[model samples]
Target: SLDGASDNETKSESGVPEVPVPADDTPEVLNKALSGLSSRWKNWWVRGILTPAMISFFFIIIYLGPMVLMMIVLCIQIKCFHEIITIGYSVYHSYHLPWFRTLSWYFLLCVNYFFYGETVTDYFFTLVQREEPLRILSKYHRFISFALYLTGFCMFVLSLVKKHYRLQFYMFGWTHVTLLIVVTQSHLIIHNLFEGMIWFIVPISCVICNDIMAYMFGFFFGRTPLIKLSPKKTWEGFIGGFFATIVFGILLSYVMSGYRFFVCPVEFNNDSNSFTVDCKPSELFQLQDYGLPPVLQSITVKLYPFQIHSIALSAFASIMGPFGGFFASGFKRAFKIKDFANTIPGHGGIMDRFDCQYLMATFVNVYIASFIRGPNPSKVIQQLLALRPDQQLHIFNSLKAHLTEKGLLPLLEEAA
Candidate 1:
């Protein structure tokens, strides 16, 4: 009887046909269904459980090898690039500019080619030199990148419609800005990873630790807002997250330092046909005696140098890293959107998760270049090996002469 009544209800009472409802699989229906869920349940399901579970899965992959981690970083870079470019497209939707999207993606390709080429040349010099095609490509990578970019520029110029010229230029600027923000920072992140998995792992972990602790503290006792850009961020949460991150960073560094796999830099070993992190750990990873300051002298505090550096890294993650998220918030406010996209169910887009991370990555790269990186003798030796016999001999003689001039020949000879 209910089925017969439903069939009758499908038609108007006057024997006119009724318009059928859209299917349940339609975007509108799906969105409505999602919107029906409570915010608390969605947030808890995604943020509390799914997010951590996903992070743990990623950590397992990272533990397996840096190459896997690098691939993950590349995927994130592409997603972030997509998110930002999509935002730009939406913002400038009124202007129908030709080749804007095409050119934006082309430029991304050019930039990634340049950056990844540099990384491969720098870190896998031996592997590159051994392959005839790779060796040629490595020699002229920048020139080729420049040529590819110029081709895109020419295409953009040729495709420019008369009335939408201004709009095209505006989009060009938008695309470049997105590239800088998304692609450039991701390059630095990979650089940090190559330096040592610890460099990559610790800073990222600190950021995650800070984010979680800040939210916990804020949810329980947030009274004063930290910034207008991010209203939910509170002073109490900031302070709590800071201390927690510092301790977490120190502990993480200590544990990672003990393992050569974590502390050693990722290098390609042609002989092994794979990348390896098997070298002796750096001074930063090794334990070192440090005297306590006057405030802590009474407590008999002695610690490794890395433990001290961990505090600095955590401070950046706790303080400056959140500004990146604040900037992202302001950007979303400008766009009048809730999140970058609905890619991650309740956690928002990949860009939302990575906004703070990109800034942290840039900071870590600069910190490494300024403080952590030194004249890597192994790399120099590899380069020397790749050179012609004449060049290698010249360099060898020059190095020997310099050592003699510096009165270090006896020391070197004795050691040899």
Candidate 2:
């Protein structure tokens, strides 16, 4: 019965003629027309030369400082949110749900308020406590966030039209998922940048390098397809990209490790009315001589510690990072769309460019937390100094009592 149904057959209820679904099971044709030399050259001009030039211009913004970088990330987050929300709107446009767009944007504002509030409270707790208003807000950040979210929920319910109820709920779900994917990850990216620009720059650059090299390698020598999710990707490209990214990551890390600007965590210095990245660099960014294995000892006597970390970073960028892109490809394919948008001539939208970066950001954040991050005593002390005298004394007394109970204070008194 299924085999007898014609492609143009209509559904009984809606009487809408079904659009034929493209067969996804077929082996992709690698020798398509775009594989020709002229087309490839044109693609290279857009994707290779022009794209990198634009990226370099943004890198100048990055070089300016973390403040500029944060602004740029905020702008990018807005653009990406716009692009994704637009897709949802287009998909559900037929329903014409009342206030869906407005509610979606409202939800975005609420989520950003929550996420950025947490970031500020966590990182700039001292600055927040210095001002009475900020101190109050910081203290009640979560409660305020919940209240704002509940307001939006109430608004959405009130705005719901009788006929478009299902569509409105669908859009609501869509908006929330998009917010989680876009907002949450962008916040983590900012966290990575603040940790040290190296965490942000290195991981992102590795992905870019991998993308470029993979494209180049695939263009020339591609034969076997890599995965069904991304038809254009090839085994040759993946292999070439992996090796190239490893070398790039190591060299970049070595060069960046020598510079305090790249190595230092960003901090807002209120005394100077500016942000500062001036501190004794962490060991990861400092040179530590590592002994070579017996086989490699004759070829090279020693290596910097970061070179080993670079291998791991590059491996993730080259291997795991592209899976983000693969996931995006599958997402687009499911929607029967070509790209998220043609915002860039060769690339898609901001979301398209950042899909891999978000995944990389998540990985870098986890890596830092697990391996690099520790209890920051200096930061804790700074926060203590910022508190009111009574509050500071309270904390000090509490700490002393805890220490005394643990028997550490008695040992310290004996030593004194």
Report how far residue 129 has shifted in candidate 2, in Å: 1.3
lDDT of 1 by residue, 336-372 (tens): 6767776765567789888888889888888888877
**TM-score quality measure for candidate 1:** 0.87
What CA RMSD would you report for each candidate? 9.9, 6.5
Choose the strongest candidate by TM-score.
1
Regions of model 2 farther than 4 Å from truth: 1-38, 297-302, 382-416
What does the lDDT read for residue 220 in candidate 1? 80
